[model samples]
Target: MAFKYSGSICSDLDKIRVFIDEILDKLNSIIKDQDTMFDLKLILNELVINGVFHGNECNNNKCVRLYLEVIDNIVRIEVEDEGKGIDYDISSYNSAELKCCGRGLIIVNGLSDEFYVKKNKVIAVKRIN
Candidate 1:
């Protein structure tokens, strides 16, 4: 079976919760493992938050596009924002120390089996057993 969701949402932090809930609801039947669900939630939150805050600069007029797909026990997540793009070394944030900022990408990278950034879009993949 395959489940997919491709949609766009306003770049507002307040809308993230509802958007995530809707995605989770759609995937509930496919993903039953609690750990995988938690990881997915975290990944979704981090990516969306980053897109809204850093990419779109919290501008509600802008929109964040999201694409989620699950097929053959593999989950693919993509988030795109309406900003220029990111230009930084992702590996530089690989530290165990806890900081207030600059941890979202690290957390997302650690949790995801595959993670990458292309222009204004972030993509992550996870294998659900």
Candidate 2:
């Protein structure tokens, strides 16, 4: 059986991290690897932040959906926002370039085994053995 967890939260910056942490806390029981835990935390943070700030524009009324699923060693994460999606093209940004912001997608793409965007939703997968 696959382990799954999902919830939606308002576009509140302060609350997003807490919600992600709660989900990760539950995932920890299933995933057992120090490196995998760290990578998953980073990936989840990047995606959720984008969903709340960029996608919903910090509008409290709008919500961001967070979803996670783990099957064996493979883990899939999905974040969707209640807003119009942007024209996301990860290929345009050079990963090496230094920037304070707008690097989340770049980071996610590099770390995840698979990454894709559909409308206002971003999905990433990583394998933890």
The most accurate candidate by lDDT is 1
Model 2, range 1-129, lDDT digits (tens) per residue?
379888899988888878988988987887779899999999999998888888898899999998899987889999999889877787777657876556898889889999998999999999886
- Candidate 1 per-residue lDDT, tens place, 13-105, comes to 667889888898778777899899999999999999899999999999999999999998899999999999886567677467666466888
Model 1 clashes, total count: 0
- Model 1 weakest lDDT span, ten residues long: 93-102
Question: In model 1, which runs have C-alpha deviations exceeding 4 angstroms?
Answer: 94-99
Identify the leading candidate in terms of TM-score. Answer: 1
TM-score of each: 0.92, 0.91
The CA lDDT at 104 in model 2 is 90
User: Per-prediction RMSD in angstroms?
Assistant: 1.5, 1.6
